[model samples]
Target: MKAKVGMEVSWHLRMLLFISFASSFLNVSYAQTNNDYDTPAAPPPGLSNCNGVFLTYSFTSRDKEYPHIKNATAQAWAFKSSATIVNTGEYEVKAWQMFVGFQHKETLVSATGATIVDSDDFPVDASNGTTFAGGSQADLKTSIETAGDFTQISAQIDITGTQFGVKPPGVPMPSIIKLVNNGYKCPKATMRGSYNY
Candidate 1:
């Protein structure tokens, strides 16, 4: 009876340990998943533009330590026509695009420099440069002034976080065009239509 009881107790202990581990693992996974893709309740309020560029990473609700930045990701877009810069309106439509992404940090993690990817050209006198980095930040004004003619500026917002030797996750395309309709200086800025990836 003692031996049988001991065996039964051992089996019960094993089962108990397994259940505990499973429960703990599930909880941890849930937490990690929650941390990965939490975005803002509403897109952060910014001055929307007609020919605008948006650089975003995956995971909005990130921890304080790493914040909203990840590794291994990309972005890209294209515009239909040119936007004239001769008016003084709140904002106008200057550019349109479809974006695709793999992985993006939910928040700003680091301010390290990234490779500039762009292909936009503006008139010398009426130029307001724009950067078209695949899925990263771009100096819009500087980019417009650099092109030789009307063209698309392409760039890669590379993530070089050494925390895990990983770049932000690869964000696929399909990120749509966002209008910068507010805080614009030109009244006649027209937005070209969008082209797909």
Candidate 2:
């Protein structure tokens, strides 16, 4: 009778141990699955669901001795540059405004195809950068059914006093360029070759 009682208690203890170990293993698996669901999945590859705006700033030429400067001792650098804005999305962007983050203390001598917003003069203060809006072409349409040039605006800007002071093959592009339109969500700019999209 004593031996039988001892065997029964031992079987009960073994069962209890097995149940505890199995439950712990199951809980760990459940927690891992729950965590996988909690995290957000990555976006699809080559997704183009949002409106797209691409800007290209090209450095045409640079002159170290700018003839416009009154002070001969002060260093003045002139740059002939052009900026192209392209709308590659499906929708039309009306009254499109662009922001140029020029950080080289440059001033705009003149600009065509786009005008400075809230300012009429060509000698706008662009030392800290400036915003531009379409002058005659104020709307950017979809790029569908386009051959060479899509719905785009090419602005030729003549600037002086860049103070960039860089060597050859060094372009004085802006630090950032963005589209400032109401009710539109712009994505971060990505570098492609020498342009930002």
Candidate 3:
């Protein structure tokens, strides 16, 4: 009789533990699934609603290299990417500033055709967000009357981090890309298959 009671008590304890674990797991899953940034909301109405300026980001390659940080490992992944901003509007865009919302804990290595505003620090901490503006050719003219590459600005950027996904929808992308200019707005970025320029 005593043995039977002990067995029953042990079984009940095991069941209780299993239920607690399952509840915790379900709570974690629910929290992760309820992320608001998973699908960004549509841009607000009014104030230059037209999508005249287009931005495209391309993941070039990933390389493993030894970083020169203080307490870093012998190897780390470096990401190479490129972005293009084309102004197809009727008027010229002067001193264009763009906001980049990089989610990974990345440290910028190099960038061309633009510079981070208000920061001379190399390898800028772009983990949260940063702004990039034109360096020399700050004005992006309209493409309506342009013949060559006068209506666009292309940038090449490199960073080092240990984030996953190198291609397609799995690739790490900025949560938001907005034209910081007063009268211009930008839509969310879209993913595209690998293609050469």
Candidate 4:
């Protein structure tokens, strides 16, 4: 009787240990799976925003006057950007200014197969060379009276450079544009200065 009782108690302890170990293993596996599923996705390149204002900018180079202006030492290039500003708050955005900064890079190859890289930064301004502004007090009040109201904005920068010349192979021009608002009202904020290209 004593031997049978001892065997029964040993079996019960063994079963309890097995159950505890299995429960711990299951919890660890579940934690790993949950973490894997909670990871976030990466954002797209060259897409950024500022205070509910989202901007999408891109750079492309081509010989607009190609073939027609054969043997031309230089070419014209265009840079463009657009934004969508949304009013998510109750207050209206009266008199808003959007400033864009650009960094231009040119990779030049000489007739002798020599290569040179040059870069410069400049601001995208209006025809009067002032920071781009929009939405008067009245316009803002009318347009953004309700939440979820939004407005569209755009900017362009045109430039001419010898780096666009096709005489030397592998010569190309590229640009990097960004928003330059130091978190202030109009006239106080300024974009990057112009470059000679």
Judging by lDDT against the true structure, name the best candidate: 2
Compared with the true structure, the alpha-carbon lDDT of candidate 1 equals 0.31
TM-score of predicted structure 4 = 0.31
Clashing residue pairs in candidate 4 (N, C-alpha, C atoms within 3 angstroms) = none
Across 1-197, the per-residue lDDT of candidate 2 in tens digits comes to 99999999999999999999999999998998897778864422223443466565655677775455455435567777666666656676688888878777777878777888846786777878888888788887666644424435223333343545443466667777787887766666555444544
Ranking by TM-score: 2, 3, 4, 1
Clashes of each: 62, 0, 0, 0
Give each model a TM-score: 0.24, 0.59, 0.58, 0.31
Ranking by lDDT: 2, 3, 4, 1
lDDT of 3: 0.63
lDDT string for model 4 (1-114, tens) is 999999999999999999999999999889988966687534323224233333332223444533445544445333222322223333444544433332233322211111
The Cα error of candidate 1 at residue 17, in Å, is 3.4
lDDT of 3 at 172: 59
Q: Indicate the residue-level lDDT of 120 in model 3.
A: 96
lDDT of each: 0.31, 0.66, 0.63, 0.35
Name model 4 segments beyond 4 Å from true.
1-63, 66-73, 78-81, 88-90, 103-130, 135-145, 151-197
* Model 2 alpha-carbon miss at residue 92, Å: 0.7
Alpha-carbon deviation at 39 in model 1, angstroms: 3.0
